[model samples]
Target: MKNIFKFWKKYSFVLLIAFITLSLFDLRFALAAVICMAAPVFSAVFKGRFWCGNLCPRGNFYDNVVAKFSRKKKVPEFLKSYLFRVLVLVLMMTVFILGIKQNWGDLYGIGLVFYRMIVITTIIGIVMSFVYNHRTWCHFCPMGTISSLVSKSRKNKHVLNVSADCVSCKICERQCSLGIIPYEYKGELLNHADCIQCGKCAVVCPKNAIGYKST
Candidate 1:
């Protein structure tokens, strides 16, 4: 299981690129992007962002970018890491409410608003990933924000800390592109709204103290 997970994590970026290319060539293939939209739904039922951790192309790109740069910035610990979650909720509520009221059936809907929103949000997500921490966009990402919320509600949800095996080496925290303090989280496992489950923490962990499991 571990080997399979590692292999998927290593190659996820390549696969995501292929999916994007196929989506461009074939409209039907656009469903590939839905994987990002749908992955959290699956995680909600299963209790982990399995796709985000091991399959998301965007996640892979952001992780690499943050890992390459941003090592100098220090993240202050805070209890309300859900700031990202709040932004996502506001955006979604605005879009869905406004979109429904405006009624996309109007000719102006797709061109003026829908397409513009999509383009602007996409740019924001990509640019933020490069400029800020990895998966930083996930905090405000409508898709991820929704997923994180749903994934935490499952009856079987569990956070596997295994921190006893951890050595207080800040590697996991430092390498975490999402800015989560792996050592500071005292839960049995991480169920936070900000966790994109990119698995970089686990990868960087020297003692392999952090990992996830569903109850």
Candidate 2:
């Protein structure tokens, strides 16, 4: 099961392509967008931003496309601010709502909205890749924002922690795509709302100090 999960995480971009193709050619598959939209919420209840870390097609885009071609740059402090994230979320949701209302119960229209969303996100991901470090758009993704909120609400579940063996080396910080300073929070259960549970910190820790633990 774990290997299957890793495989899915590694190749999730294929699902994104498949989704786009289905949306363009078969209206019946339009409902997949709805399922994708709701998946973050459901997954967050159990594993906190697991969907973002392992199942998000957008994250796959960053990993496969953006990271391959872009220069690494530090994300701006302003862009990482919670207020900016909320504003971006509001704007995205407003656009999404307007698109839904414009489509109004038609499968083709719904599919078109999903299609446009994928295109727009892809473009944004490409643009952001050139301008910022890995997965910078994730900081402001509306679905990610919502998932973070849900994870925060259910703080006791699926928490990551650090052990006393931590050397205070900042490798985890460097490994973190979201800019979280894991060493600083060592020895404490991490429930940071923005934590995507990507496990890069845990994987890179030389002492294997960081890991998941139930609270």
TM-scores for candidates 1 onward, in order? 0.68, 0.92
Q: Model 1 misses residue 202 by how many Å?
A: 2.9
lDDT of 1 by residue, 1-215 (tens): 98976666665666656654554455345434545666666765675555555566666655554446533343333312567457666877687558647855654442344334444565565655455544555556666666666766653354445356767788887766566778776335666555666666877788878777432
Query: Between which residue pairs do clashes occur in model 2?
Result: none
Pick the lDDT winner: 2
Candidate 2 Cα RMSD (Å) = 1.7
Clashing pairs in model 1, backbone N/Cα/C closer than 3 A? 159-188, 159-189, 160-188, 160-189, 161-188
Give the root-mean-square deviation of each candidate in angstroms.
4.6, 1.7
* Number of clashes recorded per candidate: 5, 0
